[model samples]
Target: MRSQDENGRANHEAGMAGGEEMEMVEVSSEMRRRHQRPRKEEAEETEEAMSVEQVFEGKRVPGWREQLTFRAFAVSFVLAVMFSIIVMKLNLTTGIIPSLNVSAGLLGYFFVKMWTSVLDKAGLLKQPFTRQENTVIQTCVVAAYGIAFSGGFGSYLFGMSETIARQTTELNDAQNVKNPKLGWMIGFLFVVSFLGLFALVPLRKIMIIDYKLIYPSGTATAHLINGFHTPQGAKLAKKQVKTLGKFFVFSFLWGFFQWFYTAGDNCGFVSFPTLGLKAYENRFYFDFSPTYVGVGMICPYIVNISVLLGGILSWGVMWPLINNQKGKWYPADLPSGSLHGLQGYRVFISIAMILGDGLYNFLKVLLRTISSFVSVVQKRGATSTLPVLDDGSPITTSPAVSFDEERRTELFLKDQIPKQVALGGYVVIAAISIITLPHIFSQLKWYYILVAYIIAPVLAFCNAYGSGLTDWSLASTYGKLAIFTIGAWAGADHGGVLVGLAACGVMMSIVSTASDLMQDFKTGYMTLASPRSMFVSQVIGTSMGCVIAPCVFWLFYKAFKDIGISGSEYPAPYAIVYRNMAILGVDGVSSLPKNCLTLCYIFFAAAILINLLRDLAPKKIAKFIPLPMAMAIPFYIGSYFAIDMCLGSLILFVWELINKAKADAFGPAVASGLICGDGIWTLPQSVLALAKVKPPICMKFLSRNMNDKVDTFITSLS
Candidate 1:
């Protein structure tokens, strides 16, 4: 069978011509036991081959195992649902439930992973499933997670009905306002969530296939699947499984310790610390939580840079400038002058910066997409006049070579980019954009919507093709651009918009991680197992997650609040904007945040200019100038990643150098071990948490032991 290229184009004319003459290599019985039947020609080529037919003919189908079954899904689901109910009760008592606030979508992902693993072990589903199956599984998982984590339809309705009541209570004592009813809120959330999913589906083909977005998690999953295909792969997989089991145990305990020991106070194990620093008072603070760590690990260098830049602009540049102007030398009680206070200025600055960046980026992407579209159209037109060639027949009246004819003859031929697919994609984008317009307008006024819709596309185009940042999910740079426009129109108090944009960015990162995980597994399946079976596994996993996620969110929210933190404890930058709008008339927006805005704009502009000039400069000079990401990231966080990346690169370089010097081959095993070790180490925490056991202290103590083992192993091999 021929493999398709990224764009589905077939390039192997030789493979096509020599298809029947190819010999099949003998595959182990283990391999045969896992896969379906081979084609007739393949079976004939290897007489001793355990055909796909023999493997399934008399074998009993698998089902969920008793011990390691879909219990995770059920447990997650029940917990999530129960938590939502608990959130309602907690909301009544505490006013806000901090831990209850989490992404329902993420909860779904975990549920799906566990559920799919169960289904895979059981013979209910075929191995290597199709894309459709994957979709189904994902949907189910989301649903499951949602059921567990969501605050329920009734809760949203209650929130809506009590909005007036809550407002009234706020007027008397703002802190005493209870949580809003869940009915309408939940309804709206579900609606938007569904829309987001719908919007993503059409974009998948372009993003995943055409754009080839590398979902790191997906890649890991693919590696895992590949490992299941052969003896070597299975051995590696077994090791990973063991390592992950231990890691989860460790992580759970670590989480508990951080919650109990470090954070111990009137507020339970988790507390959002306030530094009392004027610039950060309104900002939510925490002592480096696991969620943050996980986020840091998952988010790429580029995004981290953007966030760091935003923070610096707000705290470093803007705050200092404001303090100097006031001649107060950073007063203890920094008067709340504007929306984000000093952070407001940063917001303004970010807007201006993103605008400039967006403009440059938009034109570039537009030009590329148009160019590609035109080229494809022309190719189709030209192909209409081409002569057909088949079965080695003589080409008659053919004026030019036919790429299509050549492509079709090969078994492992690349698929052509069909006109229909492209057209369909474009149509879907248009439809989604239109459908989402009202929601956008409702949330952001019409003027803001106009600016976002008009300017965002331009920025997206510029950034995507021009700067080589092809992942154009409106929530990234364009959202920053939108924030700028909103600030410009409504003033700096709307720094909350930037906060919202950041939240969206975080959500997108989560989604991207999940999607990437699926994609990686798909790649593995393509390489080793049946594609169909893998698809099924993915579907099963994703479905379970979907259903269970909501409940988890609810549980966490309640748990956090019961301990003392407010539900709104999560740094809701957007809430700041809402407060500003409510207090200061929309017309007095200028009196909002200013210092944060200025700093943001300054840094953003500087970063964009630096990157643009570097890109336009000669190759040698450009090489010396690192990507904008280096400048955009905050010095504190960026430095850590930089050092890590540098060290990793150095290790790889040294290994390659030594291997070449000694005339020895270095294999993928070393790299795989590093990657697997990192992922596996994190797994134990989850397992221990689920098991409701106190986290194991030995896991932490054994860190030195593990490192020593690794060092010894590496040195011995050397």
Candidate 2:
């Protein structure tokens, strides 16, 4: 339950899986009763919601028809670029991104509000910024940055390259690799990313209204938008922005200062051996990473602790033990990166743990979703004839409806995207994908594409339904399933690696976008925004992302020659892991180093057992149990980041102890500023690197013997 949002990837999963506590919180009873409320009460409640939403003088809440203004789109583009850069940087570096939905809403409000204020002062204001418009900006900006993660630049997409392949296998893998190209990447995204929107259009009411799935991220975002439109909320938001700006500058300057000494590999404060040389050698040092510190603050306490625990267990214990037996367990003379050596233990064990955790959650959520569906259906009964709207809400003349619920529902269902449009759009998009994908990958057959499309909607529905319930999107897990399935189906000779990667993208995009769209719908629902405007903004944002993500990635791709290499600035840890998975899917366990499968099996079982114990344990005890997925991260990537993250968590812990209320109020803004500043630094840093500008110093650390030798050598040279 270490959520994807915690991973610095897609916020589809929102923040760190707040453990199992969320599953224990029931919304169905309350939602069902609210839905069954009487008609007269519903009308009055609806009137109240309408009155609240119409905060601007003489201005009604803009309808769906008038919400998608050019101004909103323009502001969304600016925020989209800003967020995309931050998201993409995190994706490549730690792959742990906090949910920025609230950030997006706040920033969107700040920008548009500033612009409108100027116009109002000049007496040229034609329109006021409404919560619905803010909702659009939030939806649009999130959709755009989401592409940075779902687009797979740091994972499966980049995983299909020779560079990543070289990290896993000693074989001549260049022939099998399919390196990324800007044109194909953009085209591929456009083809697959939008279909998910269509796939879930028909299920909006079923998921939101009937099932009463609490998409927490979306709901939280809606609340932020609603609050931002209030007079008091605006003042607080402005203060938060100023705080965010202050920390952002401090973080950026800190990064700039650190950069001046990072002229060579392992130079600068980033690689400081804080725990002494021995611990540093084991990857135990704090890298002084602001991004991870920020991520640590944003993630739940359990997640940060789990990651640190995993790192200590792996790098501090297991790895050293395994390395000792290298001559017997693996070929002693093999290169460090070789799969037939130590790297095999690192990669496969991590993968096993990842797959293990993923499978358990997948089954757990699937069962929960099915149970919920059946229970809801039974309640409705086969003989019951509730007149349902096209959007799936019951046409109840109930007078007991809550004001917030009825008003939101009215706005939500006001303009249902037609059932025909949803169905036809899915069909046409599927047809186009089936026809074009084979040409794109060639190894991915038309039948394969057709089968994937046929199966995608069902999986998309399952994923969307599960995410609504858990606030955890298993998109990558689903994508991993695709990689194994398609890779095995195609086999190695047919370019299985590329085929599997491509299929993963397709499956992931469909499921991911569908859930994302649903999440946005929830946001829209609570904010009294038009469903149509939400849909349009999502589509527009996604379209922008399809183009923006790759171009941004291309900058890093071209600028950083060492991007995918292990120990490099942006190792893209998941890329190598993903490619190795494809290799395993094709080559089977025979490719694993000697005894590697045995270790993988042990850790895999261990992961499942850990999860099982956490679930069975009492709530107080379960909160302390380490997450297998969080632990597995350090198994492959090493423990340096864990130190950085724990520091972040420690800072927050101290702050909270000092003043809980203030900590809760401004903690995220502080974290966001730290994260955004460091994240944004990468853009200019990449530009400088691309221009071949070098830091004037190389702050290297050496062993005592090596340092003396270097001094002696320098003396000789002088």
Which candidate gets the maximum lDDT versus the true structure?
Answer: 2
TM-score for each of the candidates? 0.48, 0.91
| Best TM-score among the predictions, by candidate number | 2
Range of the 10 consecutive residues with the lowest summed lDDT in candidate 1:
17-26
Per candidate, the number of residue pairs that clash is: 126, 16
Q: Candidate 1 residues 1-718, lDDT tens each?
A: 1000000000011110000000000001111111223446544633432242232234332221211234433444443443333323322221111111112222223344456568788956444322222222332332332222222221211222223222211121222123432332333333223222222333333433333333322222332332343456445434444443354345445555553342222243233333332423323233333323322332222333434444455445644566565533223455443223433443344334433444444443355445543443455444322111212122223344333222212211122234465346435643454454334223333344333433433333332221112212222333233333343455334433222332222222223222322342324222332223333333343344343333333343333333121233222222222222222222343444434445555665775676577557775565444333323322211122222323333454565477743211111222222322332323343344455654222212124667899889999999
Error of 2 at 247 (Å): 0.5
What's model 2's lDDT at 110?
A: 88
Each prediction's whole-model lDDT (CA): 0.32, 0.77
Cα lDDT tens digits for candidate 2, 1-718: 1122311222212133421111101011112223335668866855765555445434576878678988899999988888888877876775666656657777788899999999999999998888889989888888898788778888888988888877776333554688889999998998988998999899898777756676756765665677777879888899988888999999999989999999988899988898899999898998988988887877666767888898999899998999999889887899898888888889899889888887887887787677666655765643222332213343434345555666667767778899999999999989988888877787889888888888999998998777776566777777888999987898888888888888888888888788888888888888778889999999999999999999999998998899888888888888888888888888888978778899899998998899888878875687688877788888877888878878888998999899987787788788889988988888899899999999999987888999999999999999
- Model 2: residues >4 Å from true position, as ranges? 1-59, 170-175, 381-399
